[model samples]
Target: MTAKQRVIRVSTEQPTYAVTVLGTEISIDVNGFIPRGATSFDVRGTSGLRVYVIYNPKLVTKPIGAVRWPLNSEVEVIVASNDPSSVVNDNKVRVSYYGPTGETLIANAWLYLTCMAISLDADTSRTGVVESTANNKTKWTWGPHGEGAILLVNCDRDGPSSGNLDNAYPSVRSYEDLQDMSLMILSTQGPAGVFDSHKLLLHISMFDAGKVRVFHVNGNTSLSSYEHVLGSDKLSYAVKRSDGKARHSFFVEGLAFPDADFAGLVSLNATLLEQPSQDLPATPVFTDTVVFRVAPWLMTPNTLKPVEMFVCSIVRGQNTNQKFLEAIKILAKEANCKLTICPEVENRGDRWIQDEMEFGYVEAPHKSFPVVFDSPRNRGLKEFPFKMILGPDFGYVTREPKNGRISSLDSFGNLDISPPVTVKGKEYPLGRILIGSSFPGSGTRRMAKVVRDFLYAQKVQSPVELYSDWLTVGHVDEFLTFVPAPDRKGFRLLLASPLACLKLFKEKQKEGYGGAALFEGLGRVGRITLDEILADEYLRSDSRYVQSCIDWNRNILKRELGLSERDIVDIPQLFTLEHSSATALFPDMVNMLVLGKRLGIPKPFGPIIHGRCCLEEEVCRLLEPLGLTCTFIDDFFSYHVLSGEVHCGTNVCREPFSFHWWNILP
Candidate 1:
């Protein structure tokens, strides 16, 4: 692409000269340089320079070596220099006017030219490769073939004494915070006086000013040396060049994510402004632009290694979750993961920690960190993520519905992500995001549009909506989860199969254990025998309906995640209808906490046959060969009876995928 030309009107009445950039063109007024009575004119320039006299409407015509102008046609004069001037006024273009003879010079005008080189560059290649010669940096593209610079949301707090995210405050708090931003280099090479006469301005559009901030680094080692140059209310900054360096580097940090209105693409430009006179305003002589697309927030699947675990503990009550917390503590210790327990005073009886928030992360070529996305449920744990999790390298983000309306499907439990997979020939290295919504055209409960739009805007983890409105809690975790595997796509999708549970029960009845009762030791709940469970027609009908609902999503997962039957594990589970929505009949086994090779599952007190619970044994047989440990925690009283299970009461923050998101084709 050609650089925009700076139009300059040359006057013969005064000493005419102009300083310009090498690659940029200057439009000159030919008639203004003509003398009062001259009828003909000739234009010439230095040896290596070209002066274009455009006669045709289209500027595609070739340049002529000689030019003699009389009155043949209207013309436009353009001056271009391919190389920078070694010294000021060394290259000159002159226009001489003559009588009708065309040989006798009546008057002459001289325009002395000095050229310089200036450019602003970043990782415009979109491959995380920075090239100083990169051009066309103003536009951005998407997909594997896309090209544009990438900027990270400086949402992590790098300073130990900071009270908020690094992006929340404009000033750089520490040297570490600068590492998370993208680097932009401004290079200027010319005579020293040219810079003094012209002003270098760094500017951003007012609309994008709040989305990003630019900082000029004066020193390498100290936080005090970083200067906040452009952001927020500041649209433009006059860059000082007192030190006279050839190259100046500025760090660009993203402050917000791509949402409903923002496309995530932002541009910053360095402009060289020249003042024609003290009385006239400054005009831009040249400009170099660079675009950056902010990194999207990405989710971490259970297949990834767990780095930290969050759970809520109830101090006093019959429904206290102390036992559940203890079990998680042991599991966390075994998994070598950090554990955080939110006390009852903070959670206020809300034990569904998983529903409150989801842990994900944002990444750039320079840095990355975990960011917790808080659900708009505004429940007891609403303040938990912001007040506790958002600190010292951790980030927080949330989206609330504009209509002030939200459903159970809006909970984070309805928000899950698949392990990395390639469907057909397309690769999803960051995996696909799974969100619960009503079936198409059903007009039933669905996730809010605002939240859905936010997730979809992320681009990388293309979201897949599943049919989850059939459940009472309306959460995908009530029926499906993923666990790490030693082979076959590195993970196994565990789905709650009512058909599998019925088959197991029928097999046990045939084995002459029909009289064995479920919930054998629980006092608060009544027991039901295997024979009685199989005999209830309404229960059977409900199980079939629930199975069909799960099967609908099962097919979607198969197609979207590129999974075969071997990639899925069917855990024994049954659902019963309540108020036209399905709820777990016993503790849900599929809603388990996954920590690498270990899993904390809810104790489904199935009928004990041959000295063991068949439910537990069946789960072990299905998963043990794949190197997964199953420890059933008793969540029956604390969570199961309350319409939740192990996974609902706890949330896990896992390590980010090793593959950079920018490497993926969305």
Candidate 2:
């Protein structure tokens, strides 16, 4: 019989037998050897050993001491030892059977035992909860009962000299890169000679070997002491105990993300192998497994604090935004945020920086960093994210369509996220992702399938699609945005409302401002009075249709983000239909740059009433109550005339959420 067998059979003919007991339970079968007509039995063992006689397995509770063994039951044995056995078979357990008469002895058997302790552990309990004992370490689940270690993708560039993500290269570049990996420990305690005769192999499945890499940390604090042990090229590694230390630690780093074909969960095992003879093959005596789930990429919302702002400089073309750039520089200083200006030579006249990429992040218990998600628009600013933004501690990831087909809807401006919310008693701690697409079943225009699949696979922020194909540019930012608020959900959903603008104009006409002209003091554009604007029947009908489109998305936001009417702020705006698609009648006010308490809005140049532009006055009145400052910026000729506005021309990288993504129940 091998030492790995759980059941030890004993008879009167063979009473003495040696068995190696690890940190697991062993059952001793005494059914065949016990005499007939015996009513009960007694089990006795050494001080460090625990012995239990189970009469009825169904009724078995945690026995306090040696219990009576009736017919058709078994004996369970456990050995607890802090040190290894100094002598061979030093521990013993005896089982005595008695007949119906209490004084009569029927039969008895003795079992000799040798104990050893071995375990492999990781953060398999609560995130910060660590323990050395081997309990629930193999299986991994989700929710409140979830238990497993979390692994980061290690996609950040930790070494400035390396010019690539740390995961791309197998060799360690710096100590900071090592900090991004998860920790695993192997512990063994027993007679040294037993380990010499046995082999300990650290192995991973061929499927998982490519997903993770393990490194052995020798008993020193130097770069050369770390050795790469197992990864894509190697499936199993023989663990060396030459240092004579009872404990060893290994660092594990994830190389790939959880894609469509991969489930994100990986397991590694440490097995103790034993060879019975020279001619026999080695067999596994005990195996301890620890599981890890790769972390997902997450998006940040505008409500978060802005760490940096990105804008492109245009100085060559007739559509140069020199004045808008100056305005943004002052706003950046007011917000105390760092400003990064992409020169004209690098941008190649593509001023739409916001459409090129979106800022997000990836996190693990060990390390976290901001990751820029490049869109597949492939415009003039396509290389900006990878060449300029990706550097030390910054990551870059992108998804391109297989057929190389893309539309204006693939731009990053069509992407957005809401602040955290609770819907129908379910809390989305990371909020929800919002994407713009055609109406259901329209199948006209949509974001690329590869990009959508990648966002859905994140599992934290469940994405909600809204209809934006009605717009010529086809971006969600043109009609909707979010701003920080002092009350009510910690933020407010800002939606462009053509109906609100029409009502404001009619109220102005009633108050004897009917002759107030829009585009005042502007030479390039013609001035139109409020009375004339209200008289245009086609314009009124187009504004009604635009209201319906905004209303559709408003209702969706209410349901998906658990928002109400009070949580939404409507900004006065109008749209004119051209070729059956809507375009902003004036500079779109909702498409504005949000910097903490300050907002840089596109000046609508609406009719001036009593020495104040009614459009600017209306926006200030709605937002100022929530402790916000609005600055009207003139992007009329440079941006608005070109079919974009303030938000489309700029991008912001905000701080990540305080809550860890791993804690979410996905």
Candidate 3:
């Protein structure tokens, strides 16, 4: 056949194909086969481009004279259509062998094609610039021919702003500043067979202006996922900000610890949303390091912030506990402490107030509890010198901060059953405090490590371990507490003393009110006697164990927190039995509601009364000599019986440290 009569056939699953002969390459598709006179095409290597034929119910060539028939022959495959309006059937291929095999024999050698290859030899180059305004807005415009193409934008300091990629970005800065602002734009080919995307990389690293933010101009809103990257150099986390829109907005303030510095590059990969086959960039474009900074308070964590005393608040229901609330208010005034009344639906509901353990935070920029913020505990903290610190949620918590440098405890810790407590160290400066307490078996040790590491990072101390084995309510405040003294880093540790309570009981018995009269008409059974109450299974069974715990606690406080014997205050309070369980009385005064040096002790209700010379009078006498004042607050709900006290009913937000933690810690 003449060159004009020559026919070539091609078939492949991919949309594009390249045909090469000698040193020339020709782009071909099923719709337009090689022109009648076409012959030579571009070539890169010594050999020509090998073409493979794909057929339905594929055929195997029979070999003759030790040579593969089709392989040894000069054969060409062409997909031809006589009518221009007819649909091109990619599955059909017309074969023509110019060597030993003639046209008729070559045509019957193989089955029709199932797919045809289309050329991918389109030019992929265009021009455009990424512009970022002073107000922190970014926009990119493509050249005239660049349309219908995709651009993946990314901030090196922030993670992937478009879709998931291999390159990691920096932590989201908690505060607003443009210390390390950067953007990289990647382009992909458009449907018009042209490089219709503009690529630009902006190096706008300005400080104190704004942090890096990522946004998408246009792309697959459903398939794209945006990440808000935040964390420290050692640890990092990404929060997906995917809103299923053409644009995804990432703000620095959305991070938990945005003030932390992050050093790294970012990447962007673009994929065009085209027909039969999509055009995608193989790699992401990256940028250099980005700087992030914030206020000192956001940088360092403060635990022992100096306070005139301490801020305190109690929870009360508008419909219930009016008398109890009133009593606490008066006591708060005497102590000169700023007090707030957190409102609840029911005064006695388990979740109404006391267990709002997750409501407050020890540090500023506290995490918001979606549910608790609507409660009364969300009041302002202007009157208090420091903010009330909230303990860990103790459930499903992570060791690293979820968004930024702010660390979080793992959910394995059981706060409801774990008594979390804090103590200021005389050795460390203000805000350089530690929480001393023991974790129950219910809590995981990972929580201890997380808390410690986080506090250490913040230049504060971790919680100390205390004895919680003997009490149903595993809280340090159940047996011990502290009051800041006038002296620097000096505080008084108040401990529960069974010995003192016994001594007072003996003395009261000699005066005739400590025996049957002390228990008559008290507790669940109105006819119970003091002797009977003490001899009950609850108190008798746990007394020995509790005494041992008290001893262990006192020793650890002196060793860990550095409290001297003179600095210790033993509260003379007796334990009783209720519902076959051991519990304490209002005079177990160690659970006193504390505001600075003022103590709000529960009004004594046990049968030991010498007119005004009751447990209240005795508690006052013990506190008076230490220059500490005590006020009586009513616990009409029998808080101790319910596994709580004045302390549990309240939360506090103390003042920030007198100086930034960095100045004192370093």
Candidate 4:
């Protein structure tokens, strides 16, 4: 009756906690306290010891309280109190066992704590593959998202421990883009019953902060696919045996980093570990501090960070341009990493005022008024991809606007605009935009870029000057929305109400917009999602796009709201087909695709074109019906930003296409 067992956790229902411990055949009641099927005990495991481990998409921590064991927990322990009077309080239960000449088995993970002779043993099991159950949560949700659960593991030993000796999976940043994975183990030892008191956690940040997913692998199963991604050179062939009886030693296994720019991956599951209660950090380590492995950066370069700054031009006494020089000096004093405010304006006086309007920067007594953050330190999404340019096919193109010039990017290091100058002798391109002090949203946010590009789309003669001089307002989408390029009257109507032109708003609800609602209201077209606008025959079509749409809706809408698979698949009943969101880029992704069929959707041309250019799928479909075969423009995303140094890549602000691509920045 004195034997140890290691089991794989299948499920944890109270009373009969089913686990195949150590490849042994045995079932135990949770302290034999509760009846079977009465309640369910959630299971979870731990990760590495790092300060940031808690918030990681992969690791987890303490689960269900009572780290050692619940008061009535059906844990079988052997208490050997040599002093006889040792109190066996709620936290003082130890597993009974013999040393040197005999062996003992402790079923409850916390059984070895009350030990006088100590060391409740368990039958060790062969290592199994550990995979993340929460990896799926990392899929793009088109918006912010996250997922997580509680997990628990029982420590079947005494006051001594070592790493998660078992093999585990490496943490993942964006699993979809991961080319390869690695694993690493850590070595540590502490009180035997420490593990049961700790739990595991994992988290995932999806596609550019669009969504977030989380998961917890409880018990033994939680350890898969959560190994340390150590350098390949770190793996060594070694083994250790404990007292000839335990035959197990602790070690750290290192995995590999597949992505180039990503410094490493943090497996929230394998790394969110807590030292058993016997050993706790005086300064609690948070889920975010933990570091694990390196991988190809799925988002931005690990080393890529732009020196954030604000560009401002002071206009004093109605002679604003005079203050431009002083403003540059002020900016240069505050900023580091090399950019100076040296705007190349054909007309100095005009340039001074021009700079002011380049950005959405509106000078006022309140420097912080109606502004996002105080300065560059708090500006920009900090996640824009500017190190490289996204071309028509999502290709990473260097900013080679000039023959040999470099480019300036945002805080996240994504190239924002051509650096306004070019290198003549260097082998690489160094084209970049020269920033003016007067512009607003220059710290890194794209507000200025959005505004400038919108104006430029209007075929503006130096859109920057137009804004600073003419005081033009309203984004291109909002301005030209009701005014078609062919209609002169409509265009004038827009100019009259620069703020929220009649094209974009109604005087009744006239105080600007609610972002998306404004776009839809002025957009004129009905929302595809809100109206269930797709043809019924779409599902019955031969293409799998129909199914793809269903699947997308399920994930984008259903799983987000915890809807059933059936309800999610039934698109008609789920969302408002008329809402503008229904036809956003991702939905357009579904429109071209047919579902259920084994074959994929037969896109007429390349959806690449559909995406590259800001053409919505329904819009693209409309063109075909209208017999207008215009090219798709993938370059839109990259050219979406306001470029003070040059004209916008695509004139989305001016003509027919301006409304569709308004206020967008690459």
Candidate 5:
């Protein structure tokens, strides 16, 4: 049944995936995932582009052990849009953390943008010379069009001697000579560290024609704010001549890092004249690294950077990129810390990658694109560290799967498919009572709690094993780690992690909703004609759009999937396309569709979620990308979501290398 439409990751779905077509690297989703959203499947230039999906959920109310998907991991999809005709090519396509779950399509996948073929495709031929400025004079120079951002760190190699200041610019030796200084820097944006040489060398310099004063250059006002950057010189000297000076000679002081080496980061500077009187000529300029004394300090990642969720965006100012990086390095004499004084500037927009692209990174000199730090638990570093360091696309790790290994990223190993409670031993696929709430909110916890309550309602007479993903919660992990194995089993209850929500989101985004659809589509081809669930709220942000999805698919699955073989209808193998909890009407009704069946009604997109956008007010909702997996006490079936295990992946403790809860929750 033509179920091969380009699927986009809509929820906490794994947007990043690796494929063999591109050979080891992950082929990002170029075609958009929004169902009925985009008009056409534009797959013309599939040669060299890196694309993927990005799933950002607003709330993480699931517990650990319940799900193991990394909060923001990139999973490779099986199908490649470029080929469009092949499922498994001659070469085996492998991805690090993706498992097959019978259900094939993931829901709400966005077509994330990656690198382009080339920003400035060079022709190689020399272009006509253009009048470019050199030595403050416009001169004809020849070159190509390709220009990359030349990031120079330590260009300032201590200021030149006063004598060297005589000849600056093209032949200038001193740093005190420059016509103009511009910077297009994207820094942490808050309080940044800068190095103003004049103020730094105040104590060492002998002559004080004009004492150096460091300031935070404001991008908006073009003014500098001074809040004690350095130099407790304690005294200053006015120039010998104030208003009526033949010319004042100012020593171009140098700046330095007392600790960090020149390898990682460096410094550079330029020079300007003492208030040039009507009589005084302008100062010479030099374009070289600023060389100051060997004052340095170590900048650990833990320090300098504030401990927070993540960097939203570096606001670009109107007239200066310099405002972002120009910070005065105020090295503390006693300790290793430095108070970076930052000046205010204009707010730039947050740029993002195009559709299906994770951590939006485009190639071009075009101005005004959105950007966010996207260092959630620093997973981006290991997965997608830009091509040069690790190559542009996500590096897919293909491991030889254990023979007959049924577990993919979303599957439970050697799991039982039927529900716990016995309905005359009929063996139902989903559990007895579905304690469900739409979205990954208290829903998971609510499900756990209600499931427990439901079990208790019959006082354990249901005579079945209770399964839920809560076993993976950090709370359970804690006991699983330190507590002896004999003491691990009946651990009572659990507390879920915030990051656990990420796992759930990933499951839905990667395979949950789509997997469910696949179940209804591929299974009971002739018998069951309809499958619908209330999951509109679980959608990342567009809860409303999710509803539309339900309506469209309800009819599609009924008419489409109702034409499978008789084997599927009589004895359906539900290894794929079915979840542990929630509603289970899909398979029950699948029987009616097989004998060329139909569910009477033309549409069945009923039971939409009933919540607003969970991811809209992200900051207020505290949707921080912490490795945090929630933890809580595990009751027979009751549970709670917590904050301790929120930092899920960072913790190296091996208490939780297991996933029994997936069987219950799958």
Candidate 6:
């Protein structure tokens, strides 16, 4: 019976000695020479033009010198006569084949060559090797022990005469040249039994650095015709079928003034491909991603920013100072910004909904419900109204209990304001708030502890604790605030300097202006001379003690808050005994309000009556170096008479910043 030609893969546990080719069961012997699995080796079809097999050298106990196939067929395989002495180690065994019309054909084994030609024919002869420069016919060489080799197909009926060939195959001209061959094969014949050689190597040469190259490996070919695709718009590529290294080159450059994405975060996406074909679609291997990020510059403080608007509370009869409110309203209108009054309706506002109740809550929501209020009154806690906070993203405000509160402890009245402090070259939110150890373990220190905890959670530096038991109100606003510097990015600490105030008072006295007028309009107190009031021991003692507190806090500010002596701009004013309470006039400027770049100060009734330069002029003069425009409101009856200044009467929600809070958090 004549045998039909077929390609097959074979794997064996022992060294292949001989293989019996037959339509029925064929067999092999470990010792190498017989057919055992069937009664007789009868070839019904021709098999083995190419062979793929698995046989590890380490697994073989003995080598069966040769692999031969005994068959009855017209088809045959004639290997090169001058091949290696021992085919035991050679993974592939290539040979020639003859069709029905006597045409010669050559084929290679799959991963490893086991054996080709199921039946051997007698008329086997050698054909001389022919060299050519045409696309169809090309020169070729073999790897070590014929490990990697290719099958050549000739268009002519009669194959060339065979002879010794060159040492190695020349480098592939370009990646496109190799890709062209693949596309031709895929279009003419489908992928089934075609080119199964695992050792097929396509040597690609990269021409340009930025151009993308795609490759397709062993792909799905279940249908009669098969195709795959992968494409990229930018610089992207995929190498799906490459085991050895290839030559490559890349060139890149950077420009000093190139347009770029100003948005801090950027994302990049890319797709990789392998062995692209012109007719067949490219194969998709994988999708990759890359990310780039840059942090933003620090946010400028409100004092340094242009006014966007003014935020205030409209709680009637609770803390309203009509003159102070009207002045702020006029200033907002002049500045062309919105005046946001809380509660919308009159007398319906929460008492703690005022600006001072919540400090710098500008970021998108960072914490959750049942938040702290930091006030003796619970205003913003219950409703959490949008009008009260101004910004949708709100932070927790600390609240002090009304029933069992410690008498010496001061409320959020002092905790909310934080002077901008610079650290590690970056300015953080609420850089430094002054705390007091005067009421340690009491609500005063408790409030400080809460503020410290909150600030730390927000990744801000902790507060600097100062002695506040000396002050009558035990608050920082009465003595200090931060204001914009003339031509800088930072703020200057506006301090109520008693010494500076004394100097100004003496200068006024020398001009025949008596000190008695400084005590007028001070809430109808009993008659008392300036000398009589100054001689009181309590007044003298309180003045000296408060001055010491200011001095001590000033040093703490310099040390912890990163301030210099030059950064401290003193406001002149003197502490006076007001019947039973103590107060100051000129230095009360520290408690002033900032309306954009303008400074809203209270016209000191005492200083004006005592024949000093107008309080407005004096303040503007003192702050000229720092670039402050002063507006003196007649606040004698509304604010100064009530133990409070402009700040206590009004609150402001400053313009929002450019940076997102989440991006800067630790």
Arrange candidates, best lDDT first. Answer: 1, 2, 6, 3, 4, 5
Of candidates 5 and 4, the better by lDDT: 4
Candidate 2: misplaced stretches above 4 Å? 1-5, 8-22, 30-44, 57-90, 93-112, 125-130, 139-146, 242-245
Model 2: lowest-lDDT 10 consecutive positions: 74-83
lDDT of 5 at 461: 20
Candidate 2, residue 23: CA error in Å? 3.6
Instruction: Give the Å error, residue 554, model 2.
Output: 0.8
Question: Which candidate achieves the best lDDT against the true structure?
Answer: 1
Candidate 4 regions exceeding 4 Å error are 1-187, 190-229, 232-308, 312-323, 327-666
lDDT string, candidate 5, 628-652, tens digits: 1111111100001111111111111
- By lDDT, the better pick of 5 and 6 is 6
Q: Write the per-residue lDDT of candidate 1 for residues 1-666, one digit (tens) a residue.
A: 346477776666765778888677887776765676787667788975778676764533333553456633466677888777777777788877777766678877788887877788898775455677776688877655667789988877777643777888878887778778898988877676676567889999999999999988886747777788999989999877643237788889998899889989898999989875678889887888888999999999999999999999887778888888889999999999999888888988889999999999988766688999999999888788888888767888999987889999999999999999999999999999999998778747988898999999998999999999999999999999999898979999999999999999999999999999899989878999999999999999999999999999999999999999999999989999999899999999999999999999999999998889999999999999999999999999999999999999999999999987766767
The pairs that clash in candidate 2 are none
Candidate 2 per-residue lDDT, tens place, 1-666, comes to 112245666665556554353556666777767667676666788766756543445665443454555545444443333345655466788878777754577777788766656677877765543467636777777666667788888877777743777888777778988878888888876555565456788999999999999988886968677788989998999887542337888888888776666778999999888764668888776788898888888899888999999999999878899999999999999999999999987788899999999999888766788989999998889888887888777888899999999999999999999989899888888889999999777648899998988888888898999999989999999999999998878999999999999999999999999999889988988999999999999999999999998999999999999999999999999999999999999999999999999999999999998899999999999999999999999999889999999999999999999987766776
lDDT value, candidate 1, whole model: 0.86
Q: Which 10 consecutive residues of model 6 have the lowest summed lDDT?
A: 250-259
State the C-alpha lDDT per candidate: 0.86, 0.83, 0.36, 0.21, 0.20, 0.39
Which tens-of-lDDT digit does each residue in 1-666 have in candidate 6? 222323232222223222212221222111222222321121111233222222334542221333322222322332211121122223333322222332322221122222211111110010111111112111121212211111110001111112111101111222322311111111111121212221122122121111122223233322211211221322332223232222211101100000121222222233222233455654432222222121111222346454343334443663455556678788777656666554425224433233235334322111111112334433343333322332212323332343544432244445434445565575655454554445344333344343334433433334566655545555666778777775543677887876665555556556645444443455553343344434457755656655666788888777776677888877766665455334763337777777666777766654453344444456778787666677777656555655667666555545444433333332
Predicted candidate 3 versus true structure: per-residue lDDT over 497-616, tens digit per residue: 766665665566667664534433344535544556455565555565566667887887676665568878777666554443346744356666656566777665655464563556
Q: Which has the higher TM-score value, candidate number 2 or candidate number 5?
A: 2
Judged by whole-model lDDT over C-alpha atoms, candidate 3 comes out at 0.36
TM-score of 4: 0.20
TM-score versus the correct structure, for each prediction: 0.89, 0.89, 0.46, 0.20, 0.16, 0.48
Positional deviation of 4 in candidate 5, in angstroms? Answer: 76
User: Per-residue lDDT of 541-569 in model 4, one digit per residue for the tens?
Assistant: 31233234333323432222222332211
